[model samples]
Target: MAVQTYSGSCHCGNVRFEADIDLAEGSGKCNCSICSKTRNWSVSVKPEGFRLLSDEQATTDYQFNTQSVHWPFCRTCGVRAYGHGDIPEVGGKFVSISVACLDDVTPEQKAALAVRYADGGNNNWWNEPSDAEKQYL
Candidate 1:
């Protein structure tokens, strides 16, 4: 996959960023509670390729449950821009970008991307496949 430049920002435009990422594929959508509620569709990216163009203070963090991840949103408009996953040994890591936050990318561009379904709410996501699971998984 070739590397391509993509730009995105939070709702109020306080947090803007540009990423040189391999957009050859779409990312997975999790059926977890938080994801379902927000309808968070995303794509994967290497931690290094993703950059923070604005000051970190421009966003506020929202965490819950085990508190393993940080969902950073624009403090002004309350739009979730990105997130950090807590992996053991690696600590917190940025693994994906919210598709809704990205710009100039169309649904067709996203359709060509790969999709993975995460069982975040249920730890045993690997074991079960519900009827609706066929679409994204």
Candidate 2:
């Protein structure tokens, strides 16, 4: 209900992390090429609120577009559970956490979450997704 630490990991459990996330603050879906392809529904948190709990060496970073964000995934399982970036739009350092990767979330808790939509595919990072896109996202 409030900001609390949540455990998350990549599919193979090779990359693990903990983040202080407040679901009431909301989560989001981005209609960008990468996000759309991966279906990366996420929550944004300050970098200080995220901590890597496993081997960093077990993961690899993938960057594209302006190359401002580091999308890290488990090398073994290829699941991108979280990423970090320093972007002005988010007040400097931020960690983008994959909601699907969270370990202990309940169906009720997930249903209670507010969902924000972004039209990232058109380079509109903070705008709403198109109606047609919304249905799928």
Candidate 3:
């Protein structure tokens, strides 16, 4: 798939960034507490594929629980721009960018992309290999 460029920013326009990602692989929605509360529909990409065009000082970090993930939000607008997940097995990092913040992407194009639902809230159930596991694991 061709690499596509996407531009996005915070609601108050204090933070802005661009990313080169594969839209064909599409996006995902995690049923975890934070994600569910924020309604954050996102897509994961390698750390190197994303670029922050503005001042990094304008961003604030929010972390909870195990704190393995870093949630970066705009300080001025309180909008989550992206998040980082550690993946030691792959020797890489997973970055989840908010799809709602992405600009210039047509609604049709967004709808056409595949949406994978992750059962993060019921993470332990993923090991059971049941029908629900097959649906969102």
Taking the tens digit of each residue's C-alpha lDDT, what string does model 3 give over 1-137? 67889998989888898988898988877667788688778888888888989898899988999998899899998999788878575356888899889897789878887877766777741333345533543
TM-score of each: 0.82, 0.95, 0.85
Each candidate's clash count: 4, 0, 0
Q: For residues 26-117, could you state the per-residue lDDT of candidate 1 as single tens digits?
A: 57677777786787888767678788899999998888888887888898998887887856543446556788889877788877877666
Q: For model 3, which pairs clash?
A: none
Off by over 4 Å in 1: 89-92, 127-129, 133-137
- Candidate order by TM-score, highest to lowest? 2, 3, 1
Is 1 or 3 the stronger prediction by TM-score? Answer: 3
Name the candidate that leads on lDDT.
2
Model 2 scores worst on lDDT over the 10 consecutive residues at: 104-113
**Candidate achieving the largest TM-score:** 2
What is the per-residue lDDT of model 2 for residues 7-123, given as tens digits with 9 covering 90 to 100? 999988989999999889999998999889999889999988999999889998899988999998899999999988898876898999999999987778888888999998998
Off by over 4 Å in 3: 89-91, 124-137
Give lDDT per model, in order: 0.76, 0.90, 0.81
How well does candidate 3 match the true structure in TM-score terms? Answer: 0.85
